[model samples]
Target: MDSLTHLTNNIPWQRLTTAYGRGTDIPQLIETGQYEELSSLIEHQSTLWQTTPWVLMILLQELSKQKPEQVSLQEIQLYTAVASTINVDEMDSQHAVETMNELLDEKYLWPEDEEDDELWWEEEEPRGYDQEAFSSYFSYSYLLLKDAIPVFTAIMEENDKLAPAIQELLLMLQSEGERAVE
Candidate 1:
């Protein structure tokens, strides 16, 4: 198997987690070019983790290494998945909706006893937040995307079908203050 096929299997997934679960499923999903699964695993209703950008960086590096003439459907799917995953929206309404859904699912809005409801809300407030870690994730994501631009540009030149989406991704990367405010 190619190195990319085995890339995820080699990761220390025990120490990492995605929006869904342990990171073990990631390598297999990417290797198989399961774009839908990958999107669900990393994109929809997901919270950004410290390891998220690292995974994206590795995937982009692997994708960028493929020769344009040899670009496969699987490669394109993987590229699209990674691109969608890292393209953070300037307005994070999706994240807000996810948070609201989680709160509802956990019944955080209604307590078993009214007396304990206030305490629940108080405890839910984030404490000791790590702003640096959040910033680092975005910074790393930006740097990785910047490094992959040349490779993507070359690929886009060869694959016109991918040009528009790739161009959008490049623009997104170049935009300043694209990060969502917490």
Candidate 2:
């Protein structure tokens, strides 16, 4: 089996949180060719989730296996959405993992009762924004996508249909600005 299959089998998708809820259905959705729903679950209003990078990794792996002409429109759109969601111009990939690790160490907190809807409703006040957690989440996902630049680059070269958008993404990642990962 390929690496994507291996990862799909091994990763704890049920424990990963997405916009709506746990990512228990993600692997099944991918297996059933549900790209649109997958897109919605992995990202919401530009926020990436714990599952986003893994999902994208699998999708990219599938894309790599297909002939350029055989790539589906849904797949293209999913990747385009990813490109739009990430502001790679602001990232420092070399240090992203370190920063993510530090932030995660400081800010990784999940409520113990995730499935308790009544408990959620019992909370009178919403939680405050945790910037460190947000930054760590973004940085981790960004690094994962950044590491797939070679795959994206190869697709850009071979798939004329996706080249322009992928080119823009590549440009954003390759920019020399000194901005730290946000």
Candidate 3:
């Protein structure tokens, strides 16, 4: 896995949309280890955004590396709470993830190319926050977390205090994964 710095630098934070607005501040906050502010930006009132999964991934990595007693309760709470919001609907997300992956490949999250001399005309379309797209985004976020299950599993084994929460999250992820395939 890439170091948090590498992942933080490589993602197009300016282009990615978060719950509060553009994700321009995310990299700075992450580098500074300001997760409380980070949480507010990616998740709002149980709604997740394009930045949520990526931030959560980074948080998981950081949390798993820390000594169990040193883990931030706030960060753990944020991780599990944000996770509870991921509801993958019946959108064929296996296919959506493929589509999203292709989009990421082509820099779909970046500003679209245009010959417009007008700045307003060149403005990027809003990150699709509509119903279907939101479902797809949720599905995409679910899969990202699903990929990190082992990280949680390892953390569970090492931390007695955190095991119950991590186990609950594992159960949630497992059930969600099963539902995605059904």
Candidate 4:
């Protein structure tokens, strides 16, 4: 299968692109020839779902975080490959709600307890998250993540541990401070 097809097999980033949509930067993040940031970010974001979202949570984290720099374009593509839902497509936000609902069901994000031990139990699929949280700002749903990229980009700026290359890229890419956009 083609590489894009392969990446989607496990996470379906293209489906995410089609489902939620993203901005031009989404592609740039994936195609920037950056590997360490993409890989590390993928690991960090993936951990969120390791217990619940499994795949969905990682995608969310990726959308939430900024891509580090001095990596490889292939690596960025790999990261995006796994994303199946987005906050915004090319033109407007779409499938933001459905993607979250599907993620809720697929990853079991909502839990009776915030510290549920068996949250990571293996099964045919995961449980659903709190649907009452379907929103564009407060909620952790796809649409909210997508709609709030500008805010998150601003937040990424003040982060300290970020690599200098990545920091510079963010500043240069309009992904830093208030001017950083969604």
Off by over 4 Å in 2: 1-3, 93-114, 117-130, 172-182
Ranking by TM-score: 3, 2, 1, 4
Tell me how many residue pairs clash in candidate 2.
0
Instruction: Identify the candidate with maximal TM-score.
Output: 3
TM values, all candidates: 0.59, 0.70, 0.70, 0.24
Off by over 4 Å in 3: 88-95, 99-125, 130-133, 176-182
RMSD of 2: 5.2
**lDDT (tens digit, per residue) of candidate 2 on 1-182:** 96766868876665556777777789888887788899898888987776776687678768667776676667666666666677665554423335433432323423445666445435553121244445556666666667767877777778898887776666655445533432
Provide the clashing-pair count of each candidate structure: 0, 0, 0, 18
Error of 4 at 147 (Å): 6.3
Instruction: Compute the lDDT for candidate 2.
Output: 0.65
- Look at candidate 4 and tell me the lDDT of residue 142: 36
lDDT string for model 1 (111-136, tens) is 23434433533663421113434444
Choose the strongest candidate by lDDT.
3
